[model samples]
Target: MTPGIPGFRHARLPGADGVQLSTAIGGSGSPVVLLHGFPQTHLMWRHVAARLATEHTVICPDLRGYGASDKPAATSPDVYAKRAMAADVVSLVAALGHDRFALVGHDRGALVAFRAGLDHPETVTHLGVLDVVPTLDMWNVLHGVSAAVGYHLFLMAQPPGLPETMIANSADVFFGSFLDAWACDPAAIPDGVRAAYLRASAAAVPSIVADYRASAGIDVAHDQADFDAGSQFAMPVTVVQQDWGAQLGYDAAQVWRAWAPDLDHRLTRAGHFMAEEAPDEIAEAIRELLAR
Candidate 1:
């Protein structure tokens, strides 16, 4: 079934004190905040949110550097840190007058949700992470073809000058590659969305690189510290991933269980962008969990 999301309205919600995040809110009921991945805005949640809005209010936001948001200078990881991004979620909810809400995230958004779950479990009633693992587990599993499957991870993690220059030169090809590679149905991405992603990525090359660079550097440290402390997401977390590590001798749920004590993990046949590839299932998963 296809979801019909006509359009979205914008708001710059008060977030993390002085920081205001650009957000898109629609419908009404118990709130569900949807955070999207790299090279995508709140639009990624458009289709899913449309279906979700039938029963619940949905909030979709361009996390910091992605879309119609305040692209602040990320001089340090503390500022651009996933933890900081998580704080944006917490404050955004409060600004919208919701004390607690269900949170859903895809790709980079999933990483942000991971941080939010650990840092502010009280604010999130349910956590659904789509298409990515915890930072440290991902680092550990980046072996063999898994590393090759994510070559961009290493390239994007480079310092500002290099990735910025390289991707800036061929923004379409560089950014579009993931669009084709990750999605099972690339045709499902409209030209407007594709063009929008290209434009945003081109303009935010430095910050995008810094985002991944932090994942390689400080993000790693944060995840490692959590590992050393035997800490994981402190919530009823559900993980949905495209079993990428199957060929690499790994079980997705087993690995996720190590990070989420109260976990409900699902392995889907769809490609990496499960929200786009399997919206009905993803939407149902959120609906079911929210009911509980």
Candidate 2:
């Protein structure tokens, strides 16, 4: 195990789109793949992945376009679709010589994990989706100011160049909005950590837009395919989310129920970045889910 973060070794992963990616892996035993959300990298799972690694082999990788991954020139949201991302995880695990493993994701990562569970049900033994519902549910729930909270989704999904330029001009302000506004406790994001996210996001403008752009386009289509197929994950599943968002019309868990029949849903008081703001609680949930 790694000295401090049980799972934090840097590795390269081959993505489904023929892109080689930078990944962080640690821990030992049953393999566990950790996926990060938007504007963040694999580092988001630092704490939870570490704790899980103490018993299970934990792996956290930067999604295709976010961190040190190959930023392919793909404007068609299909290129960045959840199905493609899920394929990336499958290939990544097989690259590590595992036929199947446990899967966990937060924010955007949660969507990718959802796709993985739906598309390759045989490869995921268990799944943990944190703070998100399926893409189709999210689209229907967007109304009034709730829609404003995710304005970037529509903005970034635009024709490109413009969103990239605007985000670059105010990268810190753009990325920090969630880190600051959505935190149950603002202190969860220390200056250094906040700076790290800001720096990484600022440097990757085009890929950043592609990541969000994928949501409105191919991602939704992927989710619809699952919905049309009436697909649901057969593996044991756990969903941990903030109750406030669900109450505000997001209705996250309700959507999750349609996709995952076997799930332990827990609503908490933590903010959006539950893994960082409530590591202990998040770790407990992960541990319990993995044990099951």
How many angstroms is residue 122 displaced in model 1 relative to the true structure, after the best TM-score fit? 1.2
Query: 51-169, model 1: which lDDT tens digit per residue?
Result: 98888889998887777677777777777778878898898888889989889899898888888887787888899988888887887878876579888889978766887789889
Runs in model 1 deviating more than 4 A are: 1-7
Q: Candidates' TM-scores?
A: 0.93, 0.94
The per-model lDDT (C-alpha) reads 0.81, 0.83
What's the CA error at residue 35 for candidate 1, in Å?
Answer: 0.7
Q: Which ten residues in a row have the lowest lDDT in candidate 2?
A: 1-10
| Residue lDDT tens for model 2, 9-57 | 7889898868887888887798999898876877777778877778988
Worst ten in a row by lDDT for model 1: 1-10
